[model samples]
Target: MDDSSPPEPTGDGHYERLSLPGSEFSPLDALVALVRERGLFVLVAGGVVLLGTAYALAAPSRYTATSTVVREAQSEPEGIPSTLPSIPGLNIDPGNAGRTGLAPSAYPNLLTSREVRLAVARDTFYFPETGRRTTFVKHVNQSPGAVELLIDYTVRLPWTLMEGLGRLFRDADRRLGASGARSPLLAPSEEEQRALDALEKKVSASTQGTGALGGESGLMVVSTTAADPTLAARLNASFIEHLRRRVREIRTQNTMEHLKFVRQRLAEAGRELERAEDSLAQFLERNRSVIAGGGAPTLSFRRDRLQRQVRFKEQLYGQLQKKLTQTRLRLQRQQPVITVAEQPTPPPEPSAPNRSLIIVLSVLLGGAAGAAAVYFRSVLASAEAQESGREKLEEIRGSLTAEEIVQGVREELGRT
Candidate 1:
């Protein structure tokens, strides 16, 4: 063998290291080879670990603020039962009888709804990191840091290029010109939509319970993640506020509609009562002597009928008045949809970029990479001694080249 070539195994167990004619080298032999080349493995692994640490330090920190809430059911009147007296045009069927606005499972969906997201987006917030007051959309679209920009140009180049090209082809005149006067009924602007999308990912709601056979324990958690701890807490609070407001609106819709109906009916009953009273008053005025004394049967019968009609109208008017009062009371009794069980607070530590784990994984990957690289280099060096193997190595290098592939793509796009 040439002095530059690797020596064949020649230890007492070298015979065991040799494989059968048709088989590959044993795993034990590979392990022995890696052990012999520990220097290269350590160098690569250490470099990879150092890179991981750098990445962890440079990456944006994410702080998650969480708020725990309990779903509060709407309370019934003190003396009221599950069912109420049926009315002619009013539906007394209890709307959301046991719970508040919607099921606990539906809260996640409600928190992500367009209405809630838009409201939160338009609201002004104070960001301590920037020491500026800005809307959610502006805060979300703030310029990135140097590391973020570098990542966007490197690892995220494909996605970044796509976004850039999309913007280039977009109708800027239509979007920015006076012709962009969007109707009040139109969807949100592009920036608002992007902010809303970010909100969808950053803000989240989840329901948790003991999983009892009975029912849900009515516990929910709302969380918001951001680069700034205080901002995360503030965003969580905003999400909770909007979520509660939405729930209140949904829960009270039925009661409000019923209140309107009651008011209208009460007015009609009052009018009816007035007409009946007037008719009874006129009849008694005309037949005062006949009613007081024993008069004709027909006249007495007419008098009795008029008095009964007046009484009936009076009863109906009183009932409606009572209903109106009760409905108003119920509206007042409507409790808040959610009660804050645990207030949101800024987290001290970051929730992401586990540097230790990243470093550990990087070390392992680099070691494997280095071992495979060393093994392949030795095999190729040995193979180069044969003409056939040398030709195959050249073929592999030519196939791996990227210049031709890039040129072909450019040509294709030019033709298009």
Candidate 2:
């Protein structure tokens, strides 16, 4: 027997004797032995593979629908607002006001907003096999109420208890640490709160990925997966319509406010002009009796001064009036910043369940799981072998060690 070989169990089991072969077992040889001798292991692995294949076949198909939205950066006409004060004069080229363009970053929040979600939920329809028209929310709610009830009960009771248990487990850190004292968990910070809020919005929006469909053209892509393709198309179209309506309403409100301001200024200027004319008339009427000796020069100078004043006031009033008109026109037109670049069409093919991809993924996952099961079984078998050997050693040696014998005697005496 070679000294380097593992021991073989003796029949009495008091001590084992080792027997070594002339050549040592290589890694490749041991692996081959494990595979050949462990027929159960291979059978278990084959069973796992078969089970995984069954699961993949039994799994329901899932579909993904995608939509795209493009950002339209509408440039406000230049010089309209800048020439506001000089509307009556052509000398000054009034430039356009610096209007703030909507940022793309804002679109994620906008698309995921509660208002948009609710609008989609309300407008989207689902056609059942029965050919009945059902809104999206209604369809979701139509599922067996028992499932919802069970979920509610679980959330209301065990969920809260589990959270408390989690806190207790986490508190174990204090016992292991030097401080021994535990700090209370604090509420989330403002930034954390904002992040949570954004997360909630994103979840509600259900937007799948970073891909957006539309570019600069006010076109939006709205897509939804439903049992009926026609219903899905209609839902997308309705969502777009609602979005447009909301945008129009916002634009109209802004335009109206601007128009109101312009009209107010126009009214004030008109009142001031009237007051100036009334004052000039009153002054001339009172001074009608007082004629100068050099009537031509005095009258010409007075007339020139009054005419210049009136002309200046008239120009100011005219500019204000023009601004008021333009504002009103803009309010009426209410041009939308976003235009529909592409209208949704009924999709001929379902966007979801890419069968080829699903099958490929299923096979890969099944293979990986099968491999893992094989490895875990090998480890468990090794552990069992070590445990069995230790038990056999204990059983063969009935005599206790000094400390164990003393403790056993003491325990027996105490019981007596």
Best by TM-score: 1
Distance from true location, Cα of 239 in model 2, Å: 2.2
Tell me model 2's lDDT, rounded to 2 decimals.
0.52
On the 0 to 100 scale, the lDDT of residue 380 in model 1 is 70
* CA RMSD, predictions in order: 6.3, 11.8
Model 1: worst 10 consecutive residues (lDDT sum): 13-22
> Clashing residue pairs, candidate 1?
none
lDDT of 1 at 373: 65
Q: How well does candidate 1 match the true structure in TM-score terms?
A: 0.72
Cα lDDT of model 2 by residue, 178-290, tens digit: 35443322333223333333324223223223435334333344455454566555655655566656656656676666666666767766777787777667656765655
| TM-scores for all predictions | 0.72, 0.59
What is candidate 2's TM-score against the reference?
0.59
